[model samples]
Target: MLLVRPPGVYRAQEDTSLLRQVLRRRGRRGLVEGRSVLDIGSGTGALGIEAFRAGAADLTAIDLSRRSVLTSWLNSRLHGIPATVRRGDLFSPVNPHRFDLVLANPPYVPTADRPPSRHRMARCWDAGPDGRVLLDRICAGAPSALDEDGTLLVVQSGIAGEQATLDRCEEAGLVAETVARARIPFGPVLRARVPELRTRGLLGPDQVEEELVVIEARHG
Candidate 1:
């Protein structure tokens, strides 16, 4: 489906495609058929749209940027998909409600610079120091936003500590594990952070590929 991407809205990337494929597999297994799905950080509304095509009954998409909100909303309309797209930071707009599936492709690219970056474009990819800013938040608060049988599918870079995310999810009362993974060449952001990542021991001198993992967490 064609998508509208306004300036500052994140472009769906490889990680996004990976998660969508996983969602399709889950749907084939009947896990997502007729389920309600929430797409946190719903850039371009791509994931939410996929959820509908995958047989989900409803979709609610949230994003922090107004541009992203507009772009995602427009894309949903473009595909004739119905989505309740809202402008708000992670989970805020959906308070007091829960869904069967929560999808997230949050900011996981690490940066030395303090995040929630003032630079408009950087906000889409800049996670605080260790790149756990939004990921950590999602892990901790997902349960509250999920129905009893709900599942959370989140993708993050290995450098951001995949194990850390699993542990956090487990501690939050979720049974979590790495459900999918892929090694991708460094993107422009990672390429620019080579020196900082090396210093932080997240990247080796000769390492050029970053492993991305899709973590699936279910209520324990």
Candidate 2:
């Protein structure tokens, strides 16, 4: 089921596709019941909204974008759900090791150059020079932020070295596993680093592909 944006939210200005897919796959896995959920980098609060709908209690929606914080609040209000939307950099503002379930859809687009929109580049698309910057942080911090047996669900990219991300998680003592994956046509990462991928022997310069990988892992 798709979530309708709250009143005053600009329709068509939000991206809820990934959120829907995550919920669809994990919802059936029975992960959201009575948990204290944290939606990191929550844009428009879609992930947290679905978590709330799926039966999570005590939700927190966090984003770097001021606009997203406002929209998340609006969305929460629309759904009659109570979620705390806080503005911060990654998990910096949040208390450590305190979430039962943490969901992050961070910027996985590996870019050598940043985009014009600061919010888009920082919050939506740029992922360091190799796109693993934010992903690495999540992997590292997830262990501490998550409660014992807590799960960290992230939507990443194949173009961003999915195994490398898994390795990062494993290094952090989290057991990584792929929950779902889909091809996202002409995603921003594909457009940004075909040559770099080829140069690094990761891909052929002429080869262009679009793939999205979603991983659900638990901290040990």
Compared with the true structure, what per-residue lDDT tens digits does model 1 show for residues 42-65? Answer: 988989998898999999999888
Residue 179 in candidate 2 has what lDDT? 71
Each model's Cα RMSD: 1.0, 3.7
lDDT of 2 by residue, 84-197 (tens): 889987788787648888988877666665432363433466676677878888998888888887888888767778898889999999999887777655645466666776
Candidate 1: what lDDT? 0.90
- Segments in model 1 whose C-alpha atoms lie over 4 Å from true places: none
Runs in model 2 lying further than 4 Å from the true structure: 1-19, 114-123, 192-202
Look at candidate 2 and tell me the lDDT of residue 5.
49
Give the 10-residue window scoring lowest on summed lDDT in candidate 2.
7-16
